[model samples]
Target: MKILKNIILISLFLTVSSCQKWLTVEPEDRSTEDQLFSSVNGFYIALNGIYTDFTNPYSYGAAWTMTTLEILAQRYNVNQEHTSYTLANYGFQEETAKRTMESIWNKAYFQIASANNILEQIEKRREIFTSPVDYALIKGEALALRAMIHFDLVRLFGPMPAQGGDNAAIPYYIENNRKTAPILSLNQVLSKAITDLENAIELLKEDPIISKGPLYSDSQLGGDYQRRYRTLRLNYFATLGLLARVQLYAGNKPSAFQHAATVITQASTWFPFIKTENIMGSSKNPDRIFSTEILFSLQAPQRQQTYLAYFAPDLDGKNILAPLSSRLDQSFENNQNDFRYTPLWASGEASGKNYRVFSKYNNIEDSRLNYNNRIPLIRLSEMYYIAAESAENPNEGLTFLNTIRNARGLVSLSELAPEQWKSEIEKEYIKEFYGEGQLFFFFKRIGKATIPDGKSVNNINMTPSKYIVPLPESETRHRN
Candidate 1:
């Protein structure tokens, strides 16, 4: 509750004027919430503000996607002097680690508060919306966003579900007030998140993505561009995908498998695998992030800046986030032909040393490419991974795993022992989600005891202290 002092203010300054740039809103004073929510356009702009906040460097734009979480997963070879070295080494109490953790915590809660505020206003001003569809879309997305943010908070700061679902996790703020919400157990938090997603799914049943597909665009949907790009927002499919992820994290394999299978069976066409020409043939401007397959993503205008700061070829060795070449090779099983390997990892010269840097998010010259300036939050491939893990049997799981392997340009596996299924899936995750920040959660979800070291060939031993991020001092200090 005390963290609300530093969190509740939502900046609604931007003006939304065009269909092409509905995400862009005009900036106004923080006290304009009443004015901002007076019209339908205000609600759109307010929701847009929450999406914009996700693009902040302190959150998904950088830390969650390409930097802090990746470092924690040992995806980078950070030196002792590097800014993220302490984070990679699990020094959660160190100053740099503390600041990073606190920033992520505060920023995530800020957006949750923003979404809560929108949810409150939308109910009171439902009459302002001319079309019933608009009301559903706006309210569905607000609920989905709140659920998604809270789920991520639980993943980061809560205990691993396999080990301690009864353990107290983060507070679940449902109201837009300074009064503190009760801190819930890990299972309780996951349950709350699932409840929100289930409600969102019902409300989003009429989501355009369900009927017209994710690419469905119309300039005349009440003259609101928010309906144009459903994929960028939390569309129906993305909500299902997040639910699958949360269910799996909570150790509910049957529910996880069911939801994941739903996304794959019904929504695969909306989010297909990237064409081979996009990555293998086009060297100048490859679709490295596989944008075509992203179920949900954020439009990060400063994605190029993120590339330069961490993964650029010119960054000093001490500062860059490149893994050892041998380690990178081992991650992909030395498979040069793998779509996710050669296209995304490239040799670069930095400080007179050659490094195999992560180029999945590197900026390209062609502005016409849709892949540019986008950071994927969820992809179709992840659904496949989840289905494989939670399938009814190992053979059924192997079939699901092969689906991803073939898409990634690898031959299908014939038969595998039951014990080998998990290791194979782990390998697929390492190859599929590099620089995307899912790898760390994958490791934590399984409660792995050792992980491949980014700096050396050895494995880094893991423990609960390393897997669980401490609650930021800012939040803990204010707790009753």
Candidate 2:
């Protein structure tokens, strides 16, 4: 029965199928409007649906936003033949690259649109929210999501004016619009995002409970209903994490530090880091800190399968992907002691051929079953990095860096002068968070070295102008 449920649920979710009649919203159809936000309970359902959209690969889920954009930046595996990105890496301008970059912008706004709907519905019933906890949780999550979307936009495109005229920020679309909106300057967009996140933090100060009451909980209630609620979900910590990240990106370093510090100080109980031993499958493997480290996580029923394609070796295909020789050559050359290469990759010559592959995401339940791991959107590792970066001194940053490195069984550095220690911080960040989507932005934010791949310039120099991406074509549609 569970297998049947999994099959039905995955079929419905993993594809870009047409919307079901029940899920469609028509402008004139206020039929279910009352039920949509009638109670706090209804608002929770709407919010859950918004989060659900984020997990789709075409959206912010792992396979797309997290993976593709992260290839040039360390923290992801890349095949040599990805010419689309190869073009970007080598400084080639291509339409497909533009589309790929714009895809993240489009999808983030789509999620924001869904969130806007929830916020609009909730505002109509603002009078009913009796406790601060109820009032804050709904509004807080919406604000956080809005800020997150806008922050992504600003990071991609530069600032827009705060005003609403031809110069106003990226349409500050509190109200959803089906039509194209004008672009805002990078400054204006980030300003609004910061405001929204700040407001969310205030509301969530009561630390609202996430498991029950108005929100849907993962009831072991068997069947599609259970699958629907379990994999993609968000709670308070996720909201706070988004706020911290946005503040950091916006150059409000103090604010960024404080917000991150607040989460560390207050939410520690909820989202503790997995001990180092636990990361590599020692002790009972917690589900990638979904309950806590991930204040909110993007979900996909096929996450396990997708992860293996990149992280795991293709043992079935005679080890075609992630060849062992290459892994060893890169990670274990010149007497380097990185165990991730030695223990993680396997190399063998079978049938007169040398094959290499990864084993990180390989454990399958059955011969024909799908892997069901949820991707971690926010983790303690990230928070620790954030905390370290936000610190004013090298020593302070190194403490956090060493915490992560030592946990992974790597040697920790100590007793270095500030000038020398600065490079140490960079080294730890690149090595520790590799493939976790921190490279490009970190390079931009900190003004790091630029490594030219081909024609595309992948942050070979950290120029301030390069900090934000250009506006999407849709955003500039009304400009001219």
Error of 2 at 219 (Å): 9.0
lDDT of each model, Cα atoms only? Answer: 0.85, 0.51
* Highest-scoring model, TM-score: 1
Best-fitting candidate, measured by lDDT?
Answer: 1
User: RMSD, each candidate, Å?
Assistant: 2.4, 8.1
Q: For residues 42-131, write the lDDT of model 2, one tens digit per residue.
A: 565566566666666655564333455455343322335544344234331357656765666667666777677767767778877675
User: Which consecutive 10 residues in model 2 have the weakest lDDT in total?
Assistant: 1-10
- Distance from true location, Cα of 168 in model 1, Å: 1.2
lDDT over C-alpha atoms for residue 364 of model 2: 35
In order of appearance, the predictions have TM-scores of: 0.95, 0.72
